[model samples]
Each structure stands twice: as C-alpha cells, then as structure tokens.
Target chain A: MGTVTGKVLPQPTRDEIRVETVLQALADPVRLRMVAELANSAEPIPCGHFDVEVGKSTVTHHVRTLREAGVIEVRQVGTARASTLRKDDLDARFPGLLTGVLSGVD
Target chain B: MGTVTGKVLPQPTRDEIRVETVLQALADPVRLRMVAELANSAEPIPCGHFDVEVGKSTVTHHVRTLREAGVIEVRQVGTARASTLRKDDLDARFPGLLTGVLSGVD
Candidate 1:
C-alpha cells in the first residue's frame, strides 16, 4: 500500500493464496530465476535487479503475473519497486514447496 | 519404457527433469486434479477413469503434456492407457515437492 502516490496494488492474503496460481507463476523460466534470486537473498530486491530478456512492458507484465499469483510480494519503494518471494505464505499453504522448488537448482 | 506395442512416448529422465516444466504441467486444473488423484492412489489408473470437461483428444493432449514434463508416467495397458504420478523421481529431483504440492489439499 502506497499512501503518497495512492496506488494500491492488489495482493492476495497468505491464506487466500492457491497452489495452482503459484505453480503457474513459477512455471516460467524468467519468473522462476527472479524467484530463485530473491529466495536466496536475505533482503527484498528492486525489480530492476532482475535480468530478463523481455522488454519493459513484458517485464512488468511478468512481475504483475507473479505478484497477482501471490508467489511474491511487490510494493513501490520511492521510485523503485521492491520484490520478495512470499516464502512463508507459500510454505504455510503448501509445506516444503519452497525447499522443493529451490533444491532443483542447487 | 513400454514394449510389444512399439508406440514410444517421450519422457525426461529423472536427472534431466526441470522444475519449470513440472510446474507448468501441474499448473493446469485438469492435470493437477488428475495428478492429485493419482498421487493419492497406490495403483496406476487408466486415463479413461479421469473425469474432465475436455474432449477425448484434448484429454490426450493434457496427459501428453504431463507425461512429457516428467511429472507423470503413462504406459499402454492393453488398448487403454494407464497413468501414474512419478512421485519417486519428482521427490528425488526436487526434495519434498510431492508432499509440498499434495499437502495443499489436505
């Protein structure tokens, strides 16, 4: 929720999150890499830090897709948008999912 | 791998399996329901047993998608096709994924 700009981005509550949407968000290569990077980090990252092949609008679309699916949290941080994996919510909804998906990479 | 019929279907080896593809396959409502039913079952189920809104060809397509993603195994049994979730391979590749995804239901 951004008060100054008055732009309220929709976010699903932890209990409202569903596995189907989360799986769809993680199915994409670019989105999954973004999640992998965010998952490994201790801090939330600005969306600009994500390396993707798509153009500006496409990137925004992908991020929105993930955000809407409740796989990640995104909020405006000054001029930049900060994003982080909703690990706790996901783990709570579907236990061991975070570890399961992350373990495939390392 | 099946023999006698000579109808060869493609499948990813356990080591070659990727999370993105598996997630993509599981993202579908029909496919995921099919998987959930199969995952819970101790025995392989005939594809005909699945109740879906799609036509026969469409169901075939969905099953093929899941099979190629290496999330499930499908083999020819007489004239019908038998499908089973590849729980062992998936669990080994992405530790706890089976439990993670399945636990969402119950």
Candidate 2:
C-alpha cells in the first residue's frame, strides 16, 4: 500500500508486475482505451477525464484493475483520483510491451 | 477455416485479429510459454513437443485458445499436430506486440 496526496492506493511494485497480469488487465477493451488515453497524456489524468463511456462504478473497477496490475498508478489529486501510466517501470520490466500495445490499440 | 496438410484449422485473418483478444489469449502462463517457444523455433513444432508440464487435455485447451485467438496456427503434420507462431500476420497487424511479449516472457 502506498499513499498519494493523503489517499491510499494499493498497487504492485516493479518486481511484482507480472507479464501475464499486465496482459490480462489490457485484455479488456474499456481498460485498454483508458490506458491508451493515459499513455498519450503528458500528465496524470483525472479519472473522469478518461474517454470510456461506462458508468462511474465500472470506471472505478477498471482503474483499480489497471492499478493493481501495475500498468498505471492512481493518486488523489484534489477532489478526484488521477491516473498515470507506469511507463518507466513497465518498460524496465517488459521492454517494448507498453509501446507496442499502445501503438497496437485500435 | 483453412486446410493444413489435409486437416482443417481455423484462425483469424490479419484484419480480423484484435489486440484485446490477442492479449487475452496470451494472458495465461501456459499459453504464453507455448507462444514464446514458437517464437524461438525456426520451424513448426509438434504439439507434444512443447515444454509445458500440463496434461494432454489441458495442453489441447491452451493450444485451441491460442489458435482461436490467432496467436498460433496449428496444422496436421503426419499423425501429430504442429503449431507455428503467426509472426508475419501478427506483426503486420499489431507491429511489435508479439516480439515485445515474447521477449518479455520469463
């Protein structure tokens, strides 16, 4: 468990990030789109800023999945949670994976 | 469905391959290992030749999943089934995805 801006958001560490788990998280369409958006962004994106059309709970579920999979990090930013793709850590663990998946996103 | 040495094997075309589905197929450890082995091999490998320690039925299940997801193409080679990674088609569709995943495989 880690805290960001006083809120706790549990996520896997660099070594805990498994390739199978990362792939499983990205296997969902909505989550993949959210990751893609985060990948293209220059800064942490508020959860509401994602382009997914799902309900609030669904969005929360997807975000949690991504964070737990170590594909992204979520932190409390002001009144909302912001997410950023864990590109550096992921690249270090699985070189070329994030870039390839992001580029392959349709 | 297409014929391979007189046996029918079904697979998705280049345009039919989806990133999410491909990721889902590769999400399992067993299936991912099979794919990595295929990536390292220069020729089609017999199904029984894979290094997985699973049962025959389980291996068949995993192989079917990969074949259905368009990750590998299984064909009849003599009395046994031989599998090959669909590298060219996957590369054409998803660019560096297969390479990245295979390289990242532990």
Candidate 3:
C-alpha cells in the first residue's frame, strides 16, 4: 500500500509560530531532551532513535507537540518520521535561544 | 503597621530551579514581558510597574507563577512586592538563555 510522504504532521508556519508555544513545547522534560539532542546533532534524527524515559506513543505525542510549536520539523522519511530542530527559524524568531538553552543541557 | 518581608510568595531556591519550570514560566506572554523588562533594568521593579492587560488578581497569579518557577525572585520591598529575574542563577543553570531569549523581546 502506498503511504503518504512528506510532513505527516500539520504544523504552524515559521511566521505563524509564537514564542509562548515554543517555550511551552520545550517545558516538558522529555521534549527538552529531544530538542537538546537535536541541537547537538548536525543531521536529522529518526523518531525511534530518542531514548526518552516515556513510552513510544508518549514520545510521538511530545514530538507532535514540538512540531506544532514550530520548534522542530517532522518529515515523513519513508515509513519513519525524521525530526530536526528549526534552528534558523527559531534563532530568527527568538535569536540565540536554542544555543543558549541547549548549552546548559547535555 | 508591620508586615511580612522578603519573598512574599514562596519560591524555589536558586538551586531548586528546574529548566522545564523556567521554560513554562517564560512561555507566558505577560510573564515573559515581565522577564524581558527585568532583564533590561538593573534594579528590581515593583509588580505594579508591569503593564499587563489582565486584572490585579491575574497579574498576581502570573507573578506567583513566575516566582515559583524560579525565573524571578519576589521580595517584599516596603510593602510593595518587587520582582527581579534571577539572572545569575538562570545564567549559571542555562548559559545565555535569558540574554538570548530576552534580546529578541522588547
């Protein structure tokens, strides 16, 4: 069966994203870890790769929240969802936020 | 008449602060504006100085939320509650986070 390709999640555009949503999305421990890890890596990571304490579905939920907040972009890569930080967009919107916050985390 | 002094609202110590809570507190527009203002000022400002659109109770609620989240310190200064961002504590915890985030905001 043919599967839908590209972004499976509907997300706010970079311009549409709000500061409150970005901060709220990052407030969750699991989600923050995800973002911190993404901030460290140069390449997009697959969803299954994160070692968050929560369950798989919970991870999916967190990822969706991040995507919707415009902090991260989730692309349908084959059958897997690849996620990456919207660094440029966020930096443009909030300046050095990602770098500053991510620097404190592992 | 004699009144209470120092931290009218119970708050987390500098050490007890958490990243998630900081993000959650800053996620709010009013709270974020308060923080942005505090970031700009060298001196602590009274709670009433904030120009939030909400009512008194609501502003108090937001201030309490920010205080408890460890983003700000509230000290009862001469019966007026003065709030200041825990800049050093937050900077130590999350380097450049406040400056970076605060820079983009007014």
Best by lDDT: 2
Q: Please identify which of the two predictions, 1 or 2, would achieve the higher lDDT against the true structure.
A: 2
Give lDDT tens digits, candidate 2, residues B25-71: 99888889999998888878787889999998999899899998888
Question: Which fraction of the native contacts appears in each prediction?
Answer: 0.81, 0.70, 0.69
Error of 3 at A84 (Å): 1.3
Which of the two candidates, 1 or 2, achieves a greater TM-score against the reference? 1
For candidate 2, write residues A7-62 as lDDT tens digits: 64789989898888888999899999999888887877887888989998989889
Model 1 lDDT per residue over B27-56, tens place = 888888888888777777777788677788
lDDT of 3 by residue, A1-106 (tens): 1332576567787678777778888878889999988887777778889978878899889989999999988888778998888888988777767876786565
Error of 2 at B96 (Å): 2.1
Model 3 scores a C-alpha lDDT of 0.80
Q: Score residue B35 of candidate 1 by CA lDDT.
A: 87
Q: Estimate each model's TM-score.
A: 0.88, 0.85, 0.78
* Structure candidate 2, residue pairs in collision: none
User: What residue runs in model 1 are displaced by over 4 Å at the alpha carbon?
Assistant: A1-8, B1-9
lDDT of 1 by residue, A1-106 (tens): 3332323368999888888888888888888888889888877777677777777777788889999989888867688788878888888888998899989864
Candidate 2: regions farther than 4 A off: A1-8, B1-8
Quote the lDDT for B48 in model 1.
Answer: 75
Task: Quantify all predictions' global Cα lDDT against the true fold.
Answer: 0.82, 0.84, 0.80
